[model samples]
Target: MFGGSDIKIDVKKPVYELIVEHILTNYNFLHKQVSHHVDVEYSAVLTGLALGDGRIHSAFKRARISDENAGEIAKKLMDTNIVRLLKSRKQFTSWVDDERVSDKLLFTTPFMRFWFAFVAPIFKGIKEGNYDEFNQRYENKIAEFREAVFKELSNELVKISFAEEKVVETGAYWDREVELDIFAKTASKKVIVGTCRYTNSKLKKSEIAKLEELANRAKIKADVFVIVAKRGFSSELKSLKSEDIRLFTLKSFKSLL
Candidate 1:
């Protein structure tokens, strides 16, 4: 039973601030040693991590920038071309009204995707290392890593669900007593709660029951239930039939995209 209040997670620092400080300091230190401008692709990757996962305060703590212009500062860093842009006009034709900005800017980049998926977790592990039993405890949690990846792709998932007329609002949610991995709201005020399970094992009925209970108790409007699994549902879950319940495998999810 994972209660929202029981999850003792810390607010992490933004990766962009760290990258900026790293560039400034290293550029000064190695100005005579290196001759290349720090790559924009790499900076973008770091900024994505900072903006998405790193704590806002942490970025300020590292750089001491006032809150009034943090967004401007971040944009300036992003515009420096240290990080490569990934989205193009052709990729987002249906989503954007301004083609000029679409061509000049990217919605996202692979490096940021990679950092959010892999580097962030690894960094945490290294930071919390225990030399007494480092090797034994340092093994990565593959399931968690995969869940993070799914979180990064949540925007796309929401778009797919919307096209299917199954979702209205898609965003992550967590509070003092509860946390939903993916929350989709419908126009009728019905809520579609989903979790991304990235493993070989099938989803159990107990998990579905848990989701249902959470949805029922959530301090938000909800009417539908959804479970998105990578491996598929268990026999017990497959047998479930309810008007509010819906099941989707990863393949089915991708097909929508």
Candidate 2:
């Protein structure tokens, strides 16, 4: 959480607790990094982006700020490299309305995302040495937050796994009709669509079925279908692994190292 640090880590302590002690509780450090760049208005919009779906419309609404104000702040945030706009991969068609499809805002770094998501809103409480709200929010939302991080990392793994095929682009694909967790196009124009499940249960063949259904719904012909899970897969899913189908476990991340 502190980036590169010489501080010794205690193996027995929970990571969440350590983050609280070292990062969240230290207002002076946070202020030094953020004060020059953002004010309360900027911070509120950032917190909205972190807490909500990252859509510009949704973020503005969540922040209870006007679209004009949010738009300006979002641009400033992007200019400072605090966040980036992620456009949807849905193919533009005459029939599909572009204005209806909203672009998402993503933090440039995981630590900033974590800070806005968990620490910024409840900063007053933390500043006062009260951690009940922070702890409860962390306990409830950590899995969801980690799942997003896992999906981003899985994009890198996909590029590595497809070593023979150069992946030209990779990101989440979303439209008004459907949302796909992983979407990539190889240099040969082959479409690869997949999903990530950061859960303890083993993935089943039904996961593939769901992915295919989403692809069909989105009118995307996937040349490859991949499933990334926290645990391993069921025997039924394992049986179908082939050149067209791929499965990855959490252990696959070691290759990234």
Candidate 3:
């Protein structure tokens, strides 16, 4: 439906406006569900809860709300698609005692993440036309912000690698002890887990050991170990590497793009 008849598009303003509109719309919906007044405690609590890489308990503490209230609101927020709750992979969770709530809640998109993080917080400044404050609060944690993109890219890479096997689970894995950035399973029940490093530095050999250590702590016997780095790997990791170690640089990701 979004086609054009040789129409030239003024891309910049439209993109920003569209994103802003979405942010405002979701904010309004959330506001309505929580309270009649738009700028109230509920929205404030939500902003505190959503705009971080933390669990429900952490968010609740950040928002200064009770666990009961936080769980209720988190459920509502998750139900409304403003955010989503991803449980730690069952492989790791099954070993834990009683399988306590080990789910991570995050915004559905980076835009929503940014919106709740920056825009929603400083909306008053924007309403008052104070661009200075808005600009000041714009914290672009590039690696943190780009995590969702990296996760999806890794998922695609897994599908490519397991084209022959029935790729079962392809997502992240985390427990109290460790967090595997990308965790997947094949039809033959083969486990594949890895991490993503989007930085200027080269991937170090220590990373391989760290992944192995974490997997060991979690009692996961990963068949394939993958590393997706922005820069290339270190010479130490390159030489005398085990066949299980697989590497992918930023250039490697371009194939999927």
Top candidate when judged by lDDT against the true structure: 2
| Clashes by residue pair, model 3 | none
Q: Which residue pairs clash in candidate 2?
A: none
- Predicted candidate 2 versus true structure: per-residue lDDT over 2-25, tens digit per residue: 323334567589897678677766
lDDT for each residue of candidate 1 in 145-184, tens digit (9 for 90 to 100): 3465565465456547555565556655443345566676
Quote each prediction's TM-score: 0.51, 0.91, 0.77
Q: Model 3: per-residue lDDT, tens digit, 1-257? A: 01111223455656445434444434545434434323355555556644555477777777788877877777777776656777778544336565465467766655445555666677766655555665555435434656656666777887676677778788888766677788888888788888887778887889988988988887888888988887788899777356577788777766676
* Weakest lDDT window of 10 consecutive positions for candidate 1: 1-10
After superposition, the stretches of candidate 3 with alpha carbons farther than 4 Å from their true spots are: 1-42, 91-94, 240-243
lDDT of each: 0.48, 0.83, 0.66
For candidate 2, give the lDDT: 0.83
Q: By descending TM-score, how would the candidates be arranged? A: 2, 3, 1
- Model 1 ranges off by over 4 Å: 1-107, 113-143, 152-155, 162-166
Clashes of 2: 0
Model 3 weakest lDDT span, ten residues long:
1-10
